[model samples]
Target: MILDIYKDAFEYSAKNLVTLFVLGIFCLFSFLLIPIFLITGYNYRVINTAVHGVINGKDPLPDFDDLISMFIDGLKVVIVQIPYLLVPFVIFVIFGIISGQLTGILSNAIMIIGCLITLAAIIAACLMSQMGICHMAYNDGSFSKAFALSEIKEVIDEIGWSQCIATYLGLIIITLVISFVVTLIIAIIFAIFGVSGAALGADAGGIFGLGLVINSLVSMFIVGPYLSIFNSRSVGLLYTMQI
Candidate 1:
């Protein structure tokens, strides 16, 4: 079942190169903030399409038409995510502050406890937010549905906790592997061009700097959007188990 979800997600993402490129363009400007909304909004569309079933024998992927609506939808997605992420961040910050006020073994112990709590909070938030986003999409963009904790728990139960945890952990591992491989390839290319030995001369340093810029561009504009689409599509398909 998980394999089918990934296979369908790959096919769905690869169906239109033009759309993927457009998504990459938005991702490139994601630092500008507005573009992120469009990307998130597009992911919401993907989830909505998957949940309702694609119609008319047409591509399930949505277009960039109606920019205003896309932005609005994207804003909703951000709103849903903020609290889930924020709580963990706040917990970490509070713990850091509290830990700093003490000294010696007591301080060390408090910091360790804080770190554990923060880590747990982060993991919980990650698990909940994925399904929360799906809930929002399934309910026709109802913002409140995303935070419907009881419903979210019930949906997770229906989907089976073991399957949900395995899927989430699998995605994390896949992402880490992809990131490591991409970074390694980039490093190898730079090394081949003598950028690795930048201590040799100023010219080597300049070349190394250029390589860094190129690597950043590739990561932001190419790899980032592809992964985003893949993950979003996978989550959307995974949610179908409960439906």
Candidate 2:
């Protein structure tokens, strides 16, 4: 199943290379001309497509043709996720408010507990955000659906806790491996260039520094859409198990 998940993702990307590259470029330019909204909208579309695939028993990459709707859908998802995004900040703020009231061992204990609670809050927020977004997608972008805990629980129960956890952990490992390999390759390429540049008495520092920027952009271009699609597919597959 796991192998099939990645295989499907790779095939989808290969089939839509032009679409993927266009989306990847827009995402890379997110800081310019409000492209962030477009990027987010496309991401939301990816999730929406994933949910559709899950419900229909077939996973296919979403088309990148609906710019306006995708942007709106992405904006809706951002609205749905706002609270989850704030959880860690809220946790820390509460901790800060009470930290001054304690001292010595009590202060140390409070700090330790606060850190643990904050970490847990962050994790919970992330987990819930993913599920919440999926819920919204499944329910046609209804905001309330994202917070429907009972419905979420039913889906999770169907998927089984072990499978859910395993899928998530597997995605994490896959991401880490891809990131490490890309970074390593970029580093080696730059290292070779740096040596050649220095040997030729060119500005090796400038060449190396420029390589860093280019490498990051190249990595973003190559990895961003693929990871997004892979993650959406993984979650969608999990959601399908309930049916």
lDDT of 1 by residue, 64-129 (tens): 899999999999988888899998899988988998999999989998999899988887788789
Tell me how candidate 1 scores on lDDT: 0.81
Residues 1-243, model 2: lDDT tens digits: 656666665565555666667777888687784567776677777777766774334545677676888778777777777888798989888887788788888887887889899987776676677777888888888889888978877777777767776777788888889878887888788888999999999888888898788777766776776776667666665666676
Q: What lDDT would each prediction earn against the true structure? A: 0.81, 0.74
In every candidate, how many clashes are there?
0, 0
Could you list the CA RMSD of all candidates, in the order they appear? 3.6, 2.8
Q: Mark the 10 consecutive residues where model 1 has the least summed lDDT.
A: 51-60
- List where candidate 1 sits over 4 angstroms from the true fold: 54-59, 193-210
List the candidates' TM-scores in order. 0.84, 0.85
The best candidate by TM-score is 2
